[model samples]
Target: MRRMQKLAVLGALMLSGAAHAQSSVELYGIIDTGVMYVSNVGGHSNWLADPGTAAPNLFGLRGTEDLGGGLKAVFKLEGMFSLNNGASVNGLFGHETYVGLRDDRWGTLTAGNQIDFMFYSLVVDRWGPAFPFVSSLSLRQGSFAGLNIPNGPPGNGSFDFDRTLGAPIPNSVKYLSPTIAGLQVGAQYSFGGQAGSFGQNSGQSFGVNYHIGTVALNGAYTYVKYPELNHGNDGIRNMGAGASWVVGPAELAALYTNTENTENGARVAVYEADVTWTFSPFVHANLAYQFMKGNETLKNQKAHQETLSVMYSLSKRTSIYSGIALQQASGGPAWISLVPGPASGGSQVTGNIGLLHVF
Candidate 1:
């Protein structure tokens, strides 16, 4: 009886060790803050408290449990907040929160609030060359707030695809496919939580990416339903394709995007190009241009925006940045710069200098 009990105790200890080896968790986040000067916001030069442009100001936790047989269970919870202010996010894991199952060969399946296809397109190909300097948020989302004349400097106008379609749709499901020969694909779907209405506020998106040595390419498509927009159930469809190439110390990229609102009949299209050069091991500069066109009935008929920025890395986790942006608009309401108020001809200039640190 004593020998049998010893064997049982040893088996229990071994099983506990196996379980410990199969489970793990981690925490991570970033904080960015800076100051920006706008040349003309509401006909005045303004200095504003600007947040970091590289990554979202957020913190998060990630955990995984090995299920054996090349499978694992994973979960993540993240949130975003303002670094300049002491305010904490009120929403539960507003930035991202998801639980999923992953397989080395089969890929991953997850459900919860998560970013859509455009994020992958920008990160993988479209904005790869300009990232950390020019900021995809500024390029893709545009300076709508600065472009509104009557709404002054804080109004949001057209060309905000991510904001309009819900960049991270809640109550969503996503699938990420394993890369094969430098190629990968992903898809997502969100169910709008309107009782008795499954389609309301719902969204769907897909993305594909391919990379080979110095060249990369990506494309994405998304269709979303906004039950309360456009005076009814408005359907919006967005599509984008882009490519980037790198040679030595220089990188170049281009992207084209289309967004249309079916119910409201509003449409917007944009073309953008960028070039980034490494002046030194720690200093980099990026120059970018964007052309935006919208429906005649909508706010902006045509706009041209240009951005120039430089970044100096203090270390792997810290950097200092400065940037300038100019914008000109024709057939639009007014000239609005990327960070300032709208001008009479929809032309304005903005500049910013700031620091960012990651941990």
Candidate 2:
């Protein structure tokens, strides 16, 4: 009886070990909160403050299982939400969700609501260095705020996208190329998912990036011509270019983007610059600005906006910040918006402050 019992215990231990070896999962998140004040607006009022809360408020799970030699299968599921109000960002899954196979030599092939090759390049260029405050928060103010281009034309002359679309993109498959001599390329396809209208609503995008020493450059092109859903189905074309350089204790970057909307012959062009300086291992600051120009002939067009922000880091994942910004509208109604975030809807703003924590 004792021998039989020992055999059973060993078998159970082996099964548990095998399960642990076959899968690995991790949970990660960030809590970003702050306060914002907007002037010359009608919604809420004076000294208005709350958690800048939703900046990077997100949680995610990721795991990988070894398949074989130089190969692995991986998956990630992430969601973004507003901590103050307990509301999720966009889709059912929220931010990003995807699964794919990766090989040392062949690169990675992923499907589901993955990121666009071009968009990823631009976001990285902005976020990698400054770590300004939190992605969802910092970019909403000042010059950096102009980079906020919606997936669809602004309604009533407001530059907001249809976050209800679940994701800016849907039914997507992506391919990433292996890097060669510091150069990498990627492509993506989004299916229209419509009956008898495959070609009518489908879209394609491509991107290329190069890095050498302390300087890196990236460019991307995207074309979408979906005319079936009446959401300006005539389509839109986007092109973006950006460059970054590191020198001594400072990192500098510049970005330019152009979008042409076919349905109405409208165009939006944006220019931005970002600089970061690390005075010490635990102390650093960032400065950024952007300019936006829309079709002046369009009623309620966006005339101009400017923003500036600075922050002091308490640690690698924690910080306190303060910022001041201004916005002016033209043609029609005034369009001085902040972040359109839940706190303020990225509406026009006058001042802001807050704290951020990441884990």
Candidate 3:
């Protein structure tokens, strides 16, 4: 009789815990904005407008339900929009919305739009944020900066493609392995979604990362094949490797990327190194240098840039910043645009002043 009573109490406690876990959810997001100025672009100087936010304006929701026995159902819904232009980041396609299952012992598997393994690897390898711009630099420059053009794919008006934000993949399924003694692995695939064509514009990628104490290392590879040749034949191939070290309030990072577009027979390589020094809880400084080569604006051309900036945090969620960047292009004028397109002109300097808020 006593044993039966104890078992009933235990079961009741377990049910209560499960019920509490199932009802928990979290809402989070970051709001960043700023103003930028550029000189010597196109034939005349121009005033470049920036998104009110330093990064893409965004908001997201995350939730989890515990099923007991070290198993859980998890999901995240996130949408990105431009605060300045009031436009969706991905147009009609959702940016990063996914649902998945996670097992404490097994791993996690998710389906929907998400980041690829290569982009994630760049973050793991580099300290602080991926690049000086709003997003990871790897998106603009591949594995090694020199392997491909530093700013973007080698071509006319390539500088327009430079974005300080990370680009998420569409129609993606991703899996992340449980950490095994500080070692982790991740893989993802993006479906082309063409009727009756399984691999028309599909992409597959994978990466591995290892961290010990304050030192970390990572490597990744990605292949995007557009079989139809509508965009290009042989598609685009990107591969990258990076590393980061963190000590006290200072961190250092370096990365290299190679991006090739076989359809047009154009290739660009980029190399980058960055350092951040935190003087106090509210003050920080950043210095970065990037180099690009191969088929720049003109065939067999080259260009390079160095950027530096500093920020002072007023509070945990708000800060003010200022920065200056110097760019010099060879082969032709490398005009800078918000999105990858045609450059207005080249040999320029850019400055920005802004405030950022996070929630």
What tens-digit string does per-residue lDDT give for candidate 1 at 1-359? 12322332343334334446668767688777788777666567788877555555788777777899999877777777778775655353666667778999999998777778877665544556556665533444343332221211245544355332225656678999998998989999987766886777778899898889888898888877765464325666788888888888988888888877676566778888888899998999888898877774465567788878888999998998888777777664344333434554466677778788877
TM-score of 1: 0.84
Best by lDDT: 1
- Deviation (Å) of 297 in candidate 3: 11
Clashes of each: 8, 19, 34
Candidate 2, 142-260: lDDT as tens digits: 21222233443333232322111123345567788888898888898877666776756667777788888888888877766655325425665677888888898888888787666
Q: Which 10-residue span in candidate 2 carries the lowest summed lDDT?
A: 157-166
lDDT score, candidate 2, position 3: 31
Model 3 residue 124 lDDT? 36
- Predictions: Cα RMSD each: 8.7, 8.9, 9.2
Once superposed on the true structure, which residue ranges of model 3 sit more than 4 Å away at CA? 1-21, 128-164, 195-197, 227-233, 295-298, 336-345
